[model samples]
Target: MEQLLYITIGGSTHTATMVSNAATEALLTRLKSSPVTVTLNSSGGFEIWGALGFSLPATDEPVNAQPGDIVLYNGSNICMFYGTNSWSYTRLGKIDGLSESELRTFLKAGESNVKVTLSLSNTAGLQSVDGSVAKSNGSAYTLSGTSACAGQKGVCIKNKKKIIR
Candidate 1:
């Protein structure tokens, strides 16, 4: 089955169809445990790049990255393009259903320290009460979509029901 990567920035989520590669496989495996949030900065007016804080297996090859293209650089950094660049990178995935202008806005072009979260959607179509993709372990999520423990106060979703704790 094809896997989807959900990239959330500024509360707006975009989906990407993951490419079949070792780098992507490693990323999915890491995301299975929890979502990874990276602080990215705009570079060269073309892409938002950052260190993933973890390294992935890379099979670097010449790539002409275009808008919406996500790639891994130097085995540890992640780059999301909003303009264009030619570089050797490990292909990760490409965002879908967004135009160039939309990509710029969604990626916060020209911004610094933009927070981007990467998560995976399960094949079962299970979602948190807030309609965000559920964690791989099916844990309850808070209204903002982060994993919530029983001790957390405020509204949370578990098994598709809203529960106030």
Candidate 2:
């Protein structure tokens, strides 16, 4: 199934349709634990780019990125376009339901240190490995009866209560 990723900037949230790839998979795994916030700066009069503070697998290819395109650069940085650019980048996803002008305004084009938070839309209908419904128990845990750490994903137990991270 196609996954939707949410990007929030300046109190407005936008959705992106994620591509099915190792890089995107890794991103989703990270977000399952917590949202990622990056400080981006406008660049080349075309895009806002920044470091992700972590690396994802890169399968770079030549791409003529258009407005709303989000791509991974050098395995660690993220670039969100508001204009145009041609480069070798790992395709991440594209922001949905916005026009060019709206994208520019939403991205705060030409601005520096713009805060962008990436998260997963609330996951519904999630099932555990044993085909059980998942719930929250105030704390998170793993299905193996262990505590779910900050970076762990999947079904977990919290005080013996089932939860999905």
Against the reference, the lDDT scores of all candidates come to 0.84, 0.82
For 19-52, candidate 1 gives per-residue lDDT tens digits of 9999999999999998898999999999999999
Best by TM-score: 1
Off by over 4 Å in 1: 122-165
For the record, the alpha-carbon RMSD of candidate 1 to the native fold, in angstroms, is: 8.8
User: Which tens-of-lDDT digit does each residue in 1-165 have in candidate 2?
Assistant: 989997877655667999999999999999999888899999999999999999999999999999999999999999999999999999999999789999999899999999988988522212343323223444564433334578666655555465566
Give every collision pair in model 1.
none
In lDDT terms, which candidate is top? 1
Model 2 pairs whose backbones collide: 141-156, 141-157, 142-156
Error of 2 at 161 (Å): 29
